[model samples]
Target: MNPFRTQRPARRGGRLLALAAATVAALAPALTAGQAAAAGPAPVPALDVTSYLGTWNQLAAVPAPFNLECARDTQANYTLDPQGNVAVFNRCTTWDGGSNEIRGTARIIDQVSKAQLRVEFPNVPFQEDPAGTPNYIVTALGPDYSWAVVTDPSRLSGFVLSRTPALDDASWDQVRGAIEAAGQSPCVYLTSPTTGGIDTIAPLCTR
Candidate 1:
């Protein structure tokens, strides 16, 4: 045998090392994902609440019992209220070819980011969100407030909003990307069938 040649014990040690390396390689992805989860999703920096207040089209949203009547053509119009809160007017087409709407108020909770707010709808029989949970977090937004990804602290309910009823391919991709960045699966967001640009009511991931 050569002077530097290893015996059976050395071969065993080498095999163990190789096995450990393979194990780590297999777990690397999971570890990285865990790190991201630990960090948690956050809102964009210094959002201009004034510029953000306007009409936003509902591109896609997580299915919620409160929105069961909304078959298609969803939109939200926001304006400033004298009490320093935002007034919310959400409208959507019902299956019976009539329009339904609900009015609410959004009070900004996080003064710094200006992306966290609490919305309260008065006299609405539908109540999906838990009581006293005061966060309607805007997790993602585009430049000039072209598009937005809305989610709550729990990351369960979500909404993909746009400035118009329809969006281009790049804008659609950006919306989906924001959803993924917020640690939400696009499959949970079903597209809202508007006038154009992916009018089919299907899961966002299918498109």
Candidate 2:
């Protein structure tokens, strides 16, 4: 046996290392940690809120740095897919006011609670190699389920998605009241930018 024959194994190890690095590079976007723990448990809304399902227009949200790239009119449409998961179609106007869409799948972490769900975009990447979690809990449902206040414990991301683009004056007050009761500062909410940069602000709920 030649003294340098062992070097052959070393070359193979290098190749394996390169492949592993490549695999990790491809999965960086899908990986997230400490997300599950941040959300805690989904709170039960006081009213029968199930009727709130359907297409919801993003009328307003917190102006966070992460979502700055999303233009006004950013909306999410949730539908049931054949695979028994929630199909999420998120559309937002680009900075230049052009339409952009990201299709994703949402799986309920706990079906019975129907509170927390993981949303993954570009489902194909997940099939190849599921990595970190991108989306996490930010808010919980109100008793009526007519509206929900999603927020992460860190309070970095929050959404006030409703069943319709505009809640009636009475309903609007109820949403604000509920959010306040939950101990969140309502001032953080800003109207979602729409076409032509219109802010459809809702008056604070009186309830």
Candidate 3:
């Protein structure tokens, strides 16, 4: 009956569509922030490779199938080879009181920070690609080279290493923060066995 009556429905539909668009626009920043957070934080800018050399005890790690054989007392020893590659020696006590050791090679992939490395072990097929993943990133380090935190880009693997078998509560807290900053939940990591020392057997450490 009114001239604007016919236009009412069309105007209502237009208003609904405008509201929807405004809602999406309002959520755009939040959605983008969530995506960025999910992408994870970047790796540390620099690493002192010389001070990082020597022995490190595995204080904690995200469980991986490759390391399932290790029951406790997990440790890694790194030394520079003549050709500038890093000699990697990893050892852990098995469930049957025996020891398991693996020797590998680590090549520095990032020359600037030397924090990124590609590790390869002959006969061990962990990665499908022969070139390996350049995900081994050193995310954090202790003030005196007493502890370090390593993680990959996927956040699937992480390791807390210490110069000694045990770390102070403050250091552990720092490690937890670092792990979280790397976009990983610290609760996902299992405390590695170090009660029996670096190479000793302790079945309880497995839990």
Candidate 4:
């Protein structure tokens, strides 16, 4: 009558062990995702700010609440100020056909690489928080300054900027490669509208 008692206990233990292994397997993907999310992107080896100044069209970006008001045609114009700081003027088209513009200042944080910068937009709420610091790293750039990719250390924000409103197939491919290399998921980015001219609504890029 009690001959199967010991076998029952062994079977139960085996089942418990199997369940634990299954649970770990189920959680493996989530663990890997968390690790990837926490790992920051790598910035370009060097950045020449002198050649980086100019108007750039937004090709794609990881959506941010700060830029939520923008519907399409996002762009940024950079110029060197007399004090050696970079003047920033960002503009994007609103849903109502008007444009939203913000003025900001950018200072170099890494003198050697010149790829890291800190940007501040005065009067902007979260963006202007004095206690918080946001990283601006230039992760990629075109040889002739035709396009650039900007990202943060947190990988929460990213932007694909081009000197022109659009890039050719080859250039776009290069931009995608750079985005991936920067630890960003290209699938997560939404293409910015850049048609009917800058600051106007147009067809969106194919994902």
Candidate 5:
């Protein structure tokens, strides 16, 4: 069953209303909230993966409920881990003020193009089961492939990844424009909180 459809009736007040709205919204085919009225930025049709293979810093992103438990400095790294699979290194600060880290593998499930691919964590065998929808789309990539945006077709997911935590304001704007073109409402992006972590990241997320 779709997780969005499983709603409890006990909740009341604003929470219930918001859940109802989310369920209705999820069932619809339109892009997630904030996609309409976007203009100017032209959509880039394909991504370049060859140059895309490298470490990318997570700048700002929509806070998905699944990742909510992650610390403000949460970041993911991709490398050709041993065993010939795309290894994923996910690290974050824990709520109890500890470090959170997990290792997983990724593969190109759809093989749409050399540029586009779906990445899955927890390894391939675990993903083969029916309960697997935690996939991400490689939407837009920089010319040098130093930065990229990952979002699903439903527009329910968005991530701004870079080769470094700090990106120039002008280049960031260009990426934001491209995201808008991909039908994502730019208003949902929230800056990653970076304070007293391994990497002191300045809040680079913007509207």
Candidate 6:
């Protein structure tokens, strides 16, 4: 299950709570960020799919029902298949200390930038793209490709991924800045658990 579906996430503690000077939202809706717009940036112009293919740590994300059972260690791995399509493999650990996974295929829609892609899972039933929406958009990426910010065309979901489980203060700042630059709210995302992970599900926004 992808982490970008519709669902409200609960909070977590530690530095997140300490840094989260803003009060908690008593009830966050399924869609917490700004609606999609034609303006702002996404589909970064210089995404090298070759450099992007590999494992990425799901540091934070918008809560989704499809990921409800996932407790920790959420991540995604991408590989290029013989047909030149990106293979999508997502996995997470369950609360009962189990594991869950789903495999899918992604077709690059933006041939030029290769930042926008339509992903579909086998027997997953999310493929009826009547609206012709792009499911995966690489909105932002670190200069060194150390981190990335991903969301859908509609901005319905958001994810902050990194090469490692935990990010430094500078990287976190960069991630939040990237989200804002992409015309999306960082609050829409909550930290995911990982090895040396944040250990909290708190919103990324402080204000």
Top candidate when judged by lDDT against the true structure: 6
Q: State the lDDT of candidate 1 residue by residue for 1-207, as single tens digits.
A: 001111123343344335434443554565456545755568877779899988998888876546656657788889999998999988877666667777888888788898887887776543456554545788888778898999876665788888988878898888888887877777667777787655666667778
Kindly list the per-residue Cα lDDT of model 2 for residues 56-111, writing each as its tens digit: 66655544433444546777777778887777777775455555566677766544
Whole-model Cα lDDT per candidate? 0.71, 0.50, 0.67, 0.67, 0.54, 0.74
Candidate 4's C-alpha lDDT?
0.67
Worst 10 residues of 5 by lDDT: 1-10
TM-score of each: 0.77, 0.59, 0.74, 0.75, 0.65, 0.82
Query: Please, what's the RMSD in Å of model 3?
Result: 19.4
Stretches of model 3 off by over 4 angstroms after superposition? 1-36, 128-132, 196-207
lDDT of 3 by residue, 34-99 (tens): 546687446668877788889998987765546655557778999999999888888876555567
Model 1 ranges with Cα > 4 A deviation? 1-40, 125-133
State how far residue 187 of model 5 sits from its true place (Å): 0.8
Q: Total clashes, candidate 6?
A: 0
- Please give the range of 10 consecutive residues that has the lowest summed lDDT in model 2: 1-10
| lDDT (tens digit, per residue) of candidate 6 on 1-207 | 263231233342233433333322532342343443346356889789999999998998776556666667889999999999999889887666767788888888888888988888866655788654678899889877899999886676778888989888888999999888776777767778887968866677742
Better of 2 and 3 by TM-score: 3
- For model 3, the local distance difference test gives 0.67
Kindly report which residue stretches of model 4 are placed more than 4 angstroms away from their true locations once superposed: 1-39, 127-134, 196-206
Q: Candidate 4 lDDT, tens digit per residue, 69-135?
A: 5666777889999999899888876555666787878888877788888888665544554544447
- RMSD vs true structure, all candidates: 18.5, 15.6, 19.4, 17.3, 7.7, 5.3
Q: What's the CA error at residue 42 for candidate 5, in Å?
A: 11
User: In terms of TM-score, how similar is model 6 to the real structure?
Assistant: 0.82
Candidate 6 Cα deviation (angstroms), residue 133: 3.3
Best of the two (1, 3) by lDDT:
1
Models ranked on TM-score: 6, 1, 4, 3, 5, 2
